[model samples]
Target: MVLFDRILLAVYSLFFTVVFILFSAVMLGWPVPLFLLKDIFYPGRPEIFWPLMVILILVGGRLFWSSLHKPRGRHVVLTESALGEIKVSLHAIEDLVEKVAAQINGVREVTSQLFAVPQGVGIRIKASVTPDVNVPAVSVEVQNLVKERVFEVTGLSVSNIRVTIESISAKKPRVE
Candidate 1:
């Protein structure tokens, strides 16, 4: 998330955490917290009462909504056979791509991401390779090999494969 969202979540979490801890202390009959706190809601003016009620209502509503929310999983369905459709998780595809890409000669490190597209799946690969390797040839090889392998293994057509040579490894290939 962006900076503001992270900050807001942190602030909201901290506020609730502190309030709960103090509440537990009060329930346990801790003298320090009980003495220091003032009763802000005890038969007071409507200004404080209504605004605090609104804030609490909003907080409760947010909590209830969050409790019912479910995170969306990244998956795609392909109708391959007469039985039914096969569902493939994008994360599993990413792992397969990473393993295949890292097995390439002269590649020091490999990472991949898979996205489901209308045409098919789109793969983005980031790799660190040895400095002596030809970047253009390796990039093309990576793309072709990844595309073929994914389709061969998963029966899913790959719309495209993007390779980003993120860095060149300083270590040179050793002579046998």
Candidate 2:
């Protein structure tokens, strides 16, 4: 699936680039190669305008079709049964983990990054906890929250959850 996706993206990119170069040539009134303009239809002599419009329309149509057929998001899995390996976007998984961690009690802030490994997601979570919060307990809570949220949202199991307590806020200094 990953290979197929890359191939499709490459094809799409190539098509767009060719279209862009051709359009630029047309706009600048530069003569286009006869072979490149063979398939294009023009009422009279092949004017740059008509061919340009045709290329634009074709590119637009391809984009629309690809968008319709494309996966909803990077992290989405297309099939349940895996004949081969599946790749999920680390960014999407990280965003979900951060969201989950933010919901935990005493969590002031949460930031996370994900690393891709075979078979599962590896996550690193950095959290700011309340001054009075227990660091170890908070770490555990964050780990569990991240795991559940990522699994629920992305359908990907987390293999590792490394939690770091960055800083704890101290109580406001008493007024003199």
Candidate 3:
């Protein structure tokens, strides 16, 4: 979404919420809110009134459009399934990479993103490793392990695995 659109949405939501609250209060016999918002409820200037009304209606419609039409995530297709075609979400594959990579001795934390390549997936991993371990060795181990495990579980080849040592964490691993 564009910055301007986001700002408009935020403004719309905030004012809408406040208006609803004021309306509810008026309904419950408190007329103070109604008097406070009287000018907005019954605008005096047609030139300002028409443009503001149009903008509000357009923003409301845009909000509805956004709620109904959300972007879908990419998935890998597995054509070799015995029963039927299978689709695996790239997000799930990314989670798999994170889990596999974080199991390595030196890795303190892991985050990953996956891309669907031809007949396979490519992974980019961001890892926080222990301050005491060899970074190069740990990165290599994470890459190999993630590749192997993804293949073992999904039966899809991993085209590439790029591991970045994002941080050398001084703290010990968290227990789960």
Q: Who wins the lDDT comparison?
A: 3
Q: State TM-scores per candidate.
A: 0.63, 0.48, 0.65
lDDT of 2 by residue, 62-168 (tens): 66666678565555453456576466666666777887887887886679988766866688888788877789998998888778877776676888999988889
Which has the greatest TM-score?
A: 3
Give the Cα lDDT of each candidate: 0.80, 0.73, 0.83
| Candidate ranking (lDDT, best to worst) | 3, 1, 2
Go through the candidates in order and give the clash count of each. Answer: 0, 0, 0
Per-residue lDDT of model 1, residues 1-176, tens digit only: 44554565677788779777877898998867664344545445677667867876776666656657685777878555888779888888899999898888988678898866788678889999998889999999999899899989888889988899999988754668
Candidate 2 overall Cα lDDT vs. reference?
A: 0.73
lDDT of 2 at 112: 90
Worst 10 residues of 1 by lDDT: 35-44
Task: Look at candidate 1 and give me any clashing residue pairs.
Answer: none
C-alpha-based local distance difference test score of model 3: 0.83
Candidate 3 total steric clashes? 0
**Once superposed on the true structure, which residue ranges of model 1 sit more than 4 Å away at CA?**
1-72, 80-82, 171-176
Please report how far candidate 2 places residue 77 from its true position, in Å: 4.2
Q: List the residue pairs that clash in candidate 2.
A: none
lDDT of 2 at 71: 61
